[model samples]
Target chain A: MTAPQDNPQPKLGIIAGGGALPARLASAAQTAGRAVFVIKLDGHADDPALDEYPNVSTRLGAAAKILDAMRANECRDVVLAGKVARPSFSAIRPDWRAAKLFMKVGMKALGDDGLLRLVGEELEREGFRLVGAHDILTDLAVSEGVLGAIAPDDQAISDARRGLSVARILGQADVGQGCVVQQGLVLALEAIEGTDEMVRRSAKYRREGVGGVLVKASKPQQDKRLDLPAIGLTTIEEAHLAGLRGIALLAGGTMIIDRAAVIARADALGIFVLGLGDEDGETNHGV
Target chain B: MTAPQDNPQPKLGIIAGGGALPARLASAAQTAGRAVFVIKLDGHADDPALDEYPNVSTRLGAAAKILDAMRANECRDVVLAGKVARPSFSAIRPDWRAAKLFMKVGMKALGDDGLLRLVGEELEREGFRLVGAHDILTDLAVSEGVLGAIAPDDQAISDARRGLSVARILGQADVGQGCVVQQGLVLALEAIEGTDEMVRRSAKYRREGVGGVLVKASKPQQDKRLDLPAIGLTTIEEAHLAGLRGIALLAGGTMIIDRAAVIARADALGIFVLGLGDEDGETNHGV
Candidate 1:
């Protein structure tokens, strides 16, 4: 690591969860010449790389302590990254701040996005600027066009479009953010079971000749600062295992974690990885 | 078995698929003093009890043979029962009539319900009245209110309501007909993998204290004569295995195969079996 700068940029505070994205984001921020402080959410964030940075391991529901820790480290910019399974309300032992926020939002009534927005708003109220991991790590945001050696064939493209349409419908319902479409029929829709399980289930319905496409997109009313749709090498591997022809994600709206590795895996598997633009209206007919 | 009647209400032709519903329907029809002729769809209809009735085993896509066989038995009313896997268009070796029907419907563009309706219409054109199994077996139609000994707890009732709402949205989308919801979060949505698989998958997402409810309903635009959702004893067993608290069916719109046995199984498993009415608007709110 380079010697500490005489005057560093505002420290980026990461409320890390499971998976490699949080650590990857920290590295990206550090490389961008910004000091970082990480607060790993206990039982969720388990990356050892976080130890290399100034960090504190804290349990979920300790929102007040988290705010205090970030304040102590002089972190004015906070980014929430990685997966955090929604715990049962009874399991939560929230601090005063979190409790107040929960009371205001009516914890039981809030959906995934609702809870995220409430957290973001609460953080903002304390003078912290909520930042998406993509804001600091721009390379992780999927760009326009296909990203792997294999381009989606006509059938895959059609399936991708169908998948996107279904996903949009699902998002509008605030149900889920991903789906698999095959031969113009929806094979599976991601719910609380998550994407990998959805892909696995879709495999059972795979046809002999036609392959499906997995589409992931941010919810229509989602708060981009928190819980943006994301995929990594594991997603590519899962798609391959599910006998899918390709994976399509909303361009600039989804995070492509470990972009190079994900692309490499897709290329090796001969599965296409295409970043779909929002303007691409539904034209495919079958599904 | 009773001797063949002189003029048996124009033998009810049963287009059978997998499951006990076909056999049950045959028994019900016979008990109602109507001779039954079973045209078992190959690979799907495997019930051994079919041997007890006058039956002809035939492949799907052999629409001409099916029509001829039903006519040979002097059948005027037909009931399509159980499940038929959607065959690939290339794999379908449809006779002249089915081919013409497929061409007119644009087989590639039609959804599950669309194809079913076309088939029903074509059978009507052939002077055969397509009948739902429930019409012959009145006991198979789920009655309003709880069927099993146990009643759904407040939470299960809420989850059932939520599941029904989601199922309706999925139905409107022309997707699958069932879903599992627990504590207000959708655990799984039935797609091509079917209800059993969906229930199995939902088991993975089950929380420590709360169980889910599986809701199965008919599609909004579904051809009631062709594909009404049906649950059987196996469904009750699956729900119990999946740790679900109850099973909910759309009253009057769904078929309850082997009603007594299903209720007995559910009661033994200590799970509620409730038939939901469409008019029961969302009132319970503690899923």
Candidate 2:
């Protein structure tokens, strides 16, 4: 696989997904002296921002264009960043290349994980190294320890651990990346409904029965550029509605869109935010 | 603790919750020449029909009543059988005994295993021995081999194994006893929301291009007779909508409620059903 020349700066491929993280990762990579090859999405990403990253060539591509974009730029590693409004099955418009991918891989492949894993393999077959987002930007990786003044009670800690485990299982299979746990029981798991809905649903558990722990983590063998599990100020705000005690993220694999803002919100809400360390730190769905 | 008299038949304590299982257990025990004690439930159990057992005694109380009835009955072996609606936070009417229990145990103690462990300890303290339902009705325990004519595909089996682990974790934690898995990814984790909701809500995954496998199990410390996870005709129906491929449940330990009916439904739906031999089962939440 050809590595983008050690121009003291790498050309990274950002396979942007839905959300603000893709844009953030774009700017971060550029600032760090790396050019970005962005696969700007339709519903999931704001395309107008393409003008912001000049050296970063952008394409609103179908599958062929996507692979071509990465190959043409001689990109080193790819990262999945951001959220896109996940269209129901009827909505996914797979171009011929994407369609061919589906036919080659077949419907039997697992969910998001399968889609990513297959594409990653295809990219490698054509010569592109797939790098986990966690391996890059260690400086931006979540730092371990409570990022707030308050600490979790015993129950919250237990919930957080369990939540992390469940979330990882979901991640490993590419179902979702977050879970709400309370008193050792899982309350809700995020799917297309997303994180905010899960937070609102947790309110039902609040009647002193069993409170919840919210955990978000990265999946095993996951590509970081398309959709790095992220949390921001809004996540903190949602957690407050149901009195979530602990908020957990994968130390290296996950992104906090605005770390300072998230921490500040957590501090204000008296919620505990923690970046669990790597490898074992992230829960594997044991698939 | 003192053991029961050396009679061939043992004395059984029916720590009834909200289901018909306790009465069924009592009838079974009496037929085997044993004595029975029915600890009636306040909100969950149907009080009238429990009078069938000749020596049955009833008491309406919260979680604490389970232990007390076992002690009063002078029964050496006790089975906690039946369901209690998940008490909303406001509905948690633990008496002084249960209140004391809550005050004493922390979050770790709240896990399903912990709660059952506590129940087992409390019974031991009161000189009652807690035994598995399978021990009493081993005939009812589902066998390990596939129950229906057809076996689930490899993928469904994979999903089943994954579901088993997740179900065990949730069950051991005293949360809920069922989970739906697909392609090695968890589609739903049951909590107070229960099994039915777990199935219905799985539509999102079906649309995401993956069907699911369903699993139900008893906790390691599960006491039989009360709230053993029971799946019946309705389960198969729900699985149909969610595009489930297989269903697994503990054999002897779990009740199928209407076994024949559930299996028939599964047969028609092409959903594989296996009464997994007693690795355990628990409270089924849901609509």
Candidate 3:
């Protein structure tokens, strides 16, 4: 196995999925003075903005072709960003390399994180260093403290803590990463349908006077490089739609994509966007 | 306190909520040759069918009036049936008896089961015996077998087991009692929004070739006399609409309101409705 080069300008590969995160990662890599090579996942990466980068489009199961493209561009470091819907087993038409890896991992029943770790190991075995998008775009990682003018009140803070605790439990089961808690009661839990829909469904359960809080956190045993928990402008919009008082994300464990836009939107909606620290003991409003 | 007499015909009281279950329970109790009295919860019981029985309408927090009405008719055995939405704290205008009980139980922070237990204790103190709705309506209890011709395939059974396990975990937390699982992945967990909406949302997460299963079970520590898990014709309809292959419910623990209608609907939709036994070991697809 080869170690990643200590060269100041190592070539970076971006495996782009749907959403703005991939393009942001590409832009960040370019700004960091590194050569960028992008492999846009067919049917997932339809962003016309990605055309600005040097890229090739390929299907998800064509692992050999993806590796070949990366190697052809002399790329050593790789980052996977954005949303990739889990395809059913029948939908996977894996190439020889991917098929072998799938069989080795007992792909028939592996959860999301399990498949991700297997993919990471396969990438490392092919001599590519797996890096988190946060490595190149550090600003995307949420920082501790309130991100907007409004701060969560005592009730909202309590609900956020309850929500984060439930999320951890769900994460431990390898099920989900987000939930909405209102007045210390869990109103909704995110599963395969994703966060936006969960937020939308929470509207029916919202308390008469008390608003809920949305909590998104990384899984306890997740591969950070593959799929860190993320929230963006859509999250703020949805939270507002759900009549939630705030959004609480795990600090240093979640990605806040389009940070500036998120904060501005949260401020306009009078919603607090808080980045909770590791300790769940006390909530310092930090007004 | 008066011990309930084992007399030939002790009058039964039915605290009715929304839906056909209350009316069905009233009919069943009447058929059993017991005099029936009903206290319909104001907002929840809109069924005109309940008018067939001698009944009085009262608000949720008017416990004194409910008890008075029951005792006025010499009713001793009581059954709470159907759906009652959680009222906000400020909306609860409890009478003296309910106020005392609420203070004794710290009702403001209690979960659904906790509050139900406290209410049961209060009723017992007033010489009323709280009985499960199933006790009077034995036929409403789901039997251990598939209710329709179609059976859950191996994948669907596996998902049902997975969903039931997750639902148990959520139940232990006093959170939810239902979940949708497809191809070994949990699609959604029922929380405050109720079962029908959860089933609707699961439709968005259904896999390409494999449909999911809805699992409803009793919370491990819940009171059997209060809020037992229930399903009705609406469940079968929603499960079909969600593209679910089947429904798995805990036998003897779940109420199947309008059983004949439910079974007919499941058969017409080609959906399996299996009553899972206490042991989650094997799925007996008794067609």
Q: RMSD for each model, in Å, please? A: 3.3, 6.6, 5.3
Tens digits of per-residue lDDT, candidate 3, B55-164, equal 99998889999999999999999888878877666666788877877787563344445566677778898999999988887777887877778888777777777777
lDDT of 1 by residue, A192-267 (tens): 7778878987888777767889999877667778868899888988999899999999887788888888899899
Can you list the residue pairs that collide in candidate 1?
A184-A287, B183-B287
Worst 10 residues of 3 chain A by lDDT: A278-287
Model 1 interface root-mean-square deviation: 5.2
Each model's fnat? 0.35, 0.24, 0.38
Clashes of each: 2, 36, 0
Candidate 3 chain B, poorest ten consecutive residues by summed lDDT? B278-287
Best candidate, lDDT-wise?
1
Report the lDDT tens digits of candidate 1 across residue range B168-200. Answer: 767766778898888777888887777888899
Number of the top DockQ candidate: 1
Local accuracy of candidate 2 as per-residue lDDT tens digits, B80-180: 76665544433555677866776787544554335545666777776777776556654545667687766877777666765675566545434567777
lDDT of 3 by residue, A58-137 (tens): 98889999999999999999998878877666665788888888887664335545566677788999999999988889
Q: Taking the tens digit of each residue's C-alpha lDDT, what string does model 2 give over A1-287?
A: 23355566557887776566666767767767677777776666664665566333333327677777777777877776566544433455677876777778665343445555566677677667666554555444676667667787766765677766666655544556777776655667665567787778767755473456788887755656435677878888888878777688777667776777778778878888877765433243222
The local lDDT score (0 to 100) that residue A19 gets in candidate 1 is: 90
State which docking tier applies to candidate 1: acceptable
Worst ten in a row by lDDT for model 1 chain B: B278-287
